[model samples]
Target: MALIQGQSVDSAVRNALPPRNLGDAERLVSGALGAVVALWAIRRGGLAGGLATLAGAAMIARGTSGYCPVTETLSAKPAERQIARKQGWRSAAAAASSVTIAKPVEDVYRFFRDVANLPRFMRHVESVTVIDETRSHWVVRAPLGRTVEWDATITEDRPNERIGWRSDAGAQVRNIGWIEFRPAPGGRGTEVRAAIAYEPLAGQLGRLVAQLWGEEPGKQAHDDLRRLKQVLETGEVPTPALRRADADAAMPDAA
Candidate 1:
């Protein structure tokens, strides 16, 4: 009788957990593919790269664990477990990076605080229209020829040190981020560090947390700061369009 009860308990537990769906051969192949894609994505550096990294990580997890939450969710009956379907803020991708600017902390702080100036240096930012002292509307370029727009309001403000914001309701992409300006060592300049958490896509919440916070932040954030440095020190970025505009202005216009 005791042996039968133990067997029954084992069966119940097995039924409760998601099934190990992949065979050994399939798992090996999947893991290999994931490693390759992940390595390539890390080197690529950008939004596309970040997305690929997440995809690779999912594949790796599925291969090694042999348990796929996504597969489980699709096959799950109403009576089955609900944990596979649960998604929380922790699922959001997060990243951070820092750069030193050749400018005073207060000046760097002011530039970032004026959110409208973001488009001047932030590469993917199409525009930022100030709605009020603490609110703004942002339009940004997404992968493919797509654009995304959102309304956000500043959540925290410190005179010349830090600033933070969060997206408003019904945003296409939810965003929570902050920037800090600190004095650099040896009086060199200000050191700026930015950290952000956001749902990159509308519902891609199953991505791995480690991949989300990986090298992406350094690449994207450093690029933004590099452009900002050019703007702050030299007054403009030398992009192709700007170069053409500069060349034409010296020639002629129908004005």
Candidate 2:
């Protein structure tokens, strides 16, 4: 959302043009790398060193200023590119997850359709409060015991099939997400797919940092789905204590 805005794809393509498309976490990463490279490059004091210095500067600007014009045409997919243009979204990070649950497709869809149910399975989602039929308020846990609040509007809804949503105006974190539920091949249960695209902001960037430290969104999404399955079938969600006890029970016995 922070990327190049107010540009239409049909107008024309420019070689280098964009806005602050990077986030805090991205900037930190790029800045750190650039610093290392420049420090090393400066010692040589020649043409190759100069080129490396330029590379380091580019990386620094990418993270610090959050602007990377090259991304405008990075992976231009006709249809998806058009959609991103129309929506004013230039996201840099995305995640997708899929899971099969032992519940009917309709049942799975219903659970996801109700925003209030998300906190139960999604460990980081503090709560989702309904505002109206298509609008909802969300509070999500962030790093360092922080939290971010946002309002989101449902963009698409197809019974027992799909649902899509995006953050409303003035939201601190700009995000777009979707969920799909389909019948399993063997008629066993529901196959669910979920995806999210978000721009890095002060609040959301914290989560990105955490992602790098082993709690990536894609992995978390799958864990949430597993919890959802437990909720639906066993009416039980695995707790940390329970997992610890189980691990202890499974340990080898001394001879």
Candidate 3:
């Protein structure tokens, strides 16, 4: 949890994505995996096997319910849980990170408020061209030093509040996420939270990469917010050509 002022990004994320149920396909796969583990346990001494089976069942239940007790305790809420059953693919992954900008809540919020400014700080973001008011084209630098391009559209947004989005169909990775900002304790600053749910293209292998990478995604999220703060507070971000275009639009053209 990162606090810009008195706000806790973790707490806002907890409130944004409420717990929900997993997709049918995820429930089915989890049940099957549980059954297999149960069979293996039966062949063994039954005690350890029973424990393993219980654990597996619990995982399946949590996946199906889309609610994990641990997540609840950790101040996280479920945003999306969709099952992609095409070509025998089954996997689940989630990550979150937050950072406090030294600046006030409104300043920090406005910086992130402009999705067009995302690539200025988000390292993994290669390009975010706003094709329209709701849709945009994104080129992402993959975790393993690779690049994949896709389209994303804003699904939900509440100014000075929250922003949420999802990937377009046929994307290399199925991803969804959101950002949240809130007022601080003494009204001195703000809290910022970022949450992402993504399934890589390689199934288990992708999950392995994510785990090995651990919280790199979250760390990057923090970095992006910090840079955003610097840019907003000091106006120091090397303005990109696109940003310049935005600026030009804001100024009047002398005839």
Candidate 4:
């Protein structure tokens, strides 16, 4: 019959198509759940139950094939799908932090304007290579000895006031941020406030995991600013060992 031939052709086409989405663990879980639901629906024995069973079977097929129709419909290309995922994460997990450095606004602004100086205080930054006046490449440490790299372009620059930047597309992690330097009251120093928002390599879930492990961006920013304060004040970052040695040396001899 024509109907039987059409069904055979459909089967052949389905088998020939490559998987469009769904990771391995997702496939396994979905397959197992679909199998259970299909059996349950078939046992119910009704018109609605029959439809449910069919739906469950379709889900199982999708899982077994590692394809997700919904995602496939949304994005035909793998690269676009990955980009969508990064954008989603970037929108979901945004964080900000600020600090006050005991230095003049001009001094602090100049220090930050030179992106190369970031690694001196930022623990995770591996390096920043300046490409031009407006563009630079950055490498930062990631979990498990991995690293993330991106090219960023300066968006806004105001002398001794603020600087803003955003990463270029296709970066390992999309990021946008700004830093503001304001003169402190009573001629004390500069109030240096830095804010950064980024999507981690694995998205929001990865950020959550990092936070649970005490490696969150907010924590890093705070620590980096603290180091920056130490650096600008003393021209060096004092380690705990160094502080302890200095304390011992300063103490008078006891009987």
Maximum-lDDT candidate: 4
Better of 1 and 2 by TM-score: 2
Candidate 2 residue runs with Cα over 4 Å from true position? 1-90, 202-208, 213-215, 243-255
Among these predicted structures, which one has the highest TM-score? 4
Residue lDDT tens for model 2, 1-255:
423453544334543545566667877999999998899899987999999999999898787777765543243335544545666755334568888898998888898889899898898899899999999999987655778899999999999999999999988777788988999899889999888766544333444565655555567777888888898888779899988998999999989
lDDT tens digits by residue: candidate 1, 1-255: 999999999999989976797789888988999999999999997998999999899889889888876554333233212222332432355557888889999889988898989999988889999999999999987654578899999999998888999989888877778998999999999988898766655334323322244324345677888898888888888989988888998996678
Which pairs clash (backbone N, Cα, C closer than 3 Å) in model 3? 6-185
User: What would the per-residue lDDT of candidate 3 be over residues 89-186, giving only the tens digit for each residue?
Assistant: 25545667776565676666676767788888887788888888888888888766788888888899788888899888887777778988877666
Say what the RMSD of model 2 is.
Answer: 10.9
For model 4, the stretches where C-alpha displacement exceeds 4 angstroms are 1-91, 244-255
Q: What local distance difference test score does each model get?
A: 0.77, 0.78, 0.69, 0.81
Better of 1 and 4 by lDDT: 4
lDDT of 4 at 111: 88
Assess the local accuracy of residue 25 in candidate 1 as a C-alpha lDDT between 0 and 100: 88
- lDDT (C-alpha) at residue 68 in model 3: 54
- Best first by lDDT, ranked: 4, 2, 1, 3
